[model samples]
Target chain A: MIRTLAGLVIVLILGAVAAAVIPEMQMREELQGVGYSYASRGMDETGSSNLVTAVIVAYRGLDTLGEVVVLFCASTAVVLMLTLYPIGVKASEPSRIVAFTAKVLPAPIMLFGVYFIAHSHLSPGGGFPGGTVIASTFLLVMLGSSSVPDRNGRLPAIESLAGLSFGLLGFWGIMTAGQFLNNAFLGTGTPGSIISGGLIPLISIAIGAKVASEFSGVFKAFRNSGGEA
Target chain B: MTETLMTAIVLTLGGMMVAAGIAVLFVRDLLSAIIITGFVSLSASVMFLLMDAPDVAITEASIGAVLATMIFLWGRGKIGDDG
Candidate 1:
């Protein structure tokens, strides 16, 4: 009772504070500094209609690569720990409804996921969200089946190759443009088209592959934990 | 009129998110808490859409509400679903 009351009091106080301060907060008038440049030149220079993708894959490519590395490390750690200490997972056959839905849904789900990754430069979704959708498809498959499907290390291989592709593309940029992950080396094609963003689309594909593989590996590890798959 | 409707919707979502966030802390069962947490994320996704960030909204809805909830439920199952 006392904890609830205390929480309520704290929330009320915070709400009051926010109400007092929010109206005074200034809204940004326009894109400025790096943001302005990215907004104006991002589409033309990178040839990606999606400004966000251009910035992520071209302007700050190294940082994005670092982020991918971070994801790799985290996924690696989870897989390693789970392998070391396997949980006893009993994979029971799901209900008829769930099994039927899972079987029917994965095809369309996979299609949407690929579309998301492929059209990321022209749309809102990029590698991360698209890759996650793909991983979720695998999750659905795992849930519907009676047993965990063994990939026999295919996921890790895909992950490594995808990660390698990202680095190789950067090195390719260095050879041509004297900069890592330069998207302009191939000549900026017409924006709003699929083949417009030079290295952006390629990098998105690599990132998408890496993310999907890593997440699938983690999910498979969880599903196959102590059970011999 | 449209602007006012959006503002009202945003305010409603924000209030529900706050309520859910608080309710999660008080909930005894772990499953209920996890579902409520997903609810909070779902509300936040709506708020992001209202703020003209469809990308953020999609990511949040998928990763936060869907993926995270599934992962949590899986973990809870592993640990024995008394939670």
Candidate 2:
């Protein structure tokens, strides 16, 4: 243990020395010329205020679809883990004070989570962040009521359905527009509005649901482990 | 005006990451260490925003905060306190 600690200290000191000795790293390149033009074109054509969303869901739609698949695989692994282990433990009733706080907090948080998910297109929060918030709310529910059943099966069902819908949407894009996850068919409406970003908002909703379910599944597994031992 | 505000956000975000790293090093508890790592991930996301890479930021935040925390909890099954 002492050796490991000494090694970590040495590594940190060496890293600090190197950083002090070397010139600062310039990580970003200037977005000039056609790159800017293309981005501007995306903003104009997609009618979306969030350039990042336009780039991800429109310009690089295929990548986003693959990311969703990755998330699905991760969630599937978690489901398989819980199934194989089958930790059938439940939360013991906590102190009344703890239970009361948990009960009161979740409803307001759930409302906020839904609000964030819906307003994603128009605001700072998006599908993933909104989804995490929603997941935490579900966690609050598990903590509060203590009445919900083992959520392992429910998680898989929700995750699979959401993944399927997202995949089908991508496949539909290929069928209709000869490209994957193409929003061109849906018609990009007016810029800077919630309803204007062609299929982006719908896609965000799907992503939110998928992420929320997966996160909740992971939380459930952790809680089960705690309950057991 | 917007540019100045953005720069300030960048600085604040960077400072927060540094603070979190320092805190993680000082803390002895493994669970707290894992939790601080989550905060580090969040600060990184904010830095990503300042650098104008919101896509990378979003992914980093989600995977870093949510996914990494889950992985740490799972791995904790194998590790013990002060062992």
Query: lDDT by residue for model 1 over B1-83, one digit each (tens)?
Result: 99899988988888888899989978888899899999998888888888887777888887897788988888888775463
- B32: Cα error in model 2, Å: 3.6
| Tens-digit lDDT string for candidate 2 (A1-229) | 9998999999999999999877575555877786687576876677677776667667776787788788778777875687576654545777788789987997887787677667665655667777887787776676666555354468767777877887788888889889778876788787766677777787778888888888888777666653452
Pull out the clashing pairs in model 2.
none
lDDT, candidate 1, A62-128, per-residue tens: 9999999999999999899998998887767689999899899999998998888899889998888
Model 2, B13-60: lDDT tens digits are 778888889888788888898899999998888788777676567667
Candidate 1 residue pairs in backbone clash: none
Which candidate comes out best when scored by lDDT? 1
- List ranges where model 1 is wrong by over 4 Å: A1-25, B80-83
